[model samples]
Target chain A: MINKTVATLEESVAGIFDGATVMIGGFGTAGQPAELIDALIHQGARDLTIVNNNAGNGDIGLAALLKAGRVRKIICSFPRQSDSHVFDSLYRAGQIELELVPQGNLAVRIQAAGAGLGAIFTPTGFGTLLAEGKETRHIDGKDYVLEYPIKADFALIKAHKGDRWGNLTYRKAARNFGPIMAMAADCTIAQVNQIVSLGELDPESVVTPGIFVQRLVRIQHQPAASAA
Target chain B: MNKWNRDQIAQKVALDIPEGAYVNLGIGLPTRVANFLPPDREIILHSENGILGMGPAPLPADIDPDLINAGKEPVTLQPGGCYFHHGDSFAMMRGGHLDICVLGAFQVSRRGDLANWHTGAPDAIPAVGGAMDLAIGAKKVYVMMDFLTKTGDCKLVDTCEYPLTGIGCVDRLYTDLAIIDIHQGQLLVRELADGLTFDDLQRLTGVTLTYQPAH
Candidate 1:
């Protein structure tokens, strides 16, 4: 019985101390582990660093976590959007730090962290201001900038289904960063829509294999009273 | 001459796209190009958030909570549409797999330099997501924007003052006033808007231009 199922979101996300580096899986709210995020909020971990694609949207999920002053910094590709007021206010006020990365670079950097690579050379932001302060090298007459891996202490991810052994499958585009983030983190906690018995998940269809996941929690879709 | 409306500009850009091209319609005005794409043409739409073969905006009832473009707007998946991991999608972009990518720009230089994702203003919000990859990776990079800023300053400049998205990456520029091509460091006029002339566009642009009508 290779069951990795935890009793609750809080138990699954336990041992996340302050000043932790956490990777959140999502593009906006799609693949976000809302239950895990809510639990982290209630657990009141502070001074955390978060890595994701975007900053946050509306006042729910990651936005709520940031609004609660839990996050000390964010490393993301796009931190500015119409719906991300919380990040906007905090960033403008110099309360929260931001490390803006290019989208492709962000994805590959996380992938590198998972694959045990120290660094990678990508051509995505070669001549731009984003490439400033980074090492640049020419390979076959084309410029490539060096980007280091982005590993995290814990990864909070969302999935459509997960077996007791932690084999995970995501829904549609919602699978954006979940699989990569799971591999890039030391302990990956997945909040899933359903938890099945071992051998229930089709190994062929498993997007994130049980090897990358450490714990799982069946999500209860109850929205919090408020985070604003 | 009356400036082309946003939809008209999108329609013009849509007309120039060839059949069987794989295109990534960027956020903002470029996203409108999908609505104008001819139904008979089979252009695959790619969104950087891992969606490919995307369709136009879905109706209220047909909106799928899980399916969305990079802009986070709900969209329909075409018959052949599929989604993948973000890493794989970006590999397709940076690996030069896309045929074309249409993006909105703040400024485009005579040498086809792009500067769109940010302004150097102190209070400006910095958001550089996938523009750099698209600019350098796509086979053809097209920019769709107004010829000039609202205050009447030319967006097509001799040199970009803002941060560069990619070095000499733009192939064609589709603006309300004209459609121009950047060839060998020259801005070649392909088509002028109705009631606009070569001299008038040259004056408004404040840059050197040569007229070579599209055949």
Candidate 2:
């Protein structure tokens, strides 16, 4: 078993040196760790390889890293190319690299990575770009595509509330990426709006088990910060 | 009933929306389409939150506390509308089951890319919600917004200045001044609001626009 140590969110996350791989919990922006992202931005760390759902809305979450020119490559389900076409321009300019993963396949990959599976077969991308350049296998007279597991050194996520024991609850869209990523990272650093004591949370309300969390930080959103 | 300005835009966008087409109205203004649906036509409304038989937003007094859409907003289910798991709803979206998805836009490019989630503000709540899935998973995407920015700059741009949500996924645009299509990497004017001309739209836009007058 891996040895354990205690650290604050800042200290635990400081393990992420330059060129570290990070798996952030968020689908688009729903489950993104805004406070932690802000912390990373303030640190101005660079050369990150991030795995996420949709290279989430820019300059707000992971996009802040993009804006700060910190991330070097991104492994995600979709690339950001809408309003800010600069992402495409940057990719074309080789400013950063993108590894496109199918949403279903990506979800399964994170699951497999967390489970310590080297790779697995999925039917999600039987005939799309996801099928190209990957191992293929057939079962029951049909084709299946091979997907590799992805785990990161650091996992950044947000929780609606967390206990000192590390159990968590997510509110609404924030629920999407948190559970999946929390289980898949080597170390998870969560920024929660509130922190309660152990056993205070109902069993059913704990979306992510305490086992996955290494450290928790209570970061209150100042009311002015959340105003639309 | 007095219509909210955003609701008026939703109604205008749905006025000629064809019958028998499966449409997914986005949250917020687009959600108002359910209230404006024409009884003479059968336009199936799909809510990402997992209701297929979505009725219009109920009158406040008629609201059922139990009935809600994927957004968790209270809704009135239509007679034929049914509730399902969110997974099933996303299946309908990712499975190419939608005919059209009308979403609000932060910025739309000449090529019809949509960027709606982040406003690029330094400190704000960053939530994509379902915009990414809806933006890319739907069969076709349409954006609804006014022609110019609050400062009066055109939102139709040569390139989106905001962080993008989907690339090459948008097809049509319904603005207060014009109805346009993204064709071959250009915004082609197809129709216009009353008293609006092609030149007027061009003056209000920041991108190079092509005009295709309706016959």
Clashes of each: 0, 6
lDDT of 2 by residue, A17-83 (tens): 7988888875445456776887787776789998876664544656767777888988876565343
Candidate 1 per-residue C-alpha lDDT over B1-215 given as tens digits, one digit per residue, 9 for 90 to 100: 87799999999989888999999999999999988999898999999988888887789887666788988888888888888898999999999999999999999999999999999899998999999999999999999999989999999998899999998999999999999999997889999888999999999876899999997
In candidate 2, the residue pairs with backbone N, CA or C atoms under 3 Å apart (3 or more residues apart, or in different chains) clash, namely A59-A63, A82-B164, A83-B160, A84-B162, B49-B70, B53-B81
lDDT of each: 0.91, 0.70
Model 2 RMSD vs true structure: 10.2
Clash count, candidate 1: 0
Query: What are the chain A TM-scores for all the models, listed individually?
Result: 0.96, 0.89
Name the best candidate (by lDDT): 1
The CA-based lDDT of model 2 is what? Answer: 0.70
Model 2 chain B lDDT-worst window of ten: B122-131
Q: Would candidate 2 be rated incorrect, acceptable, medium or high by CAPRI criteria?
A: incorrect
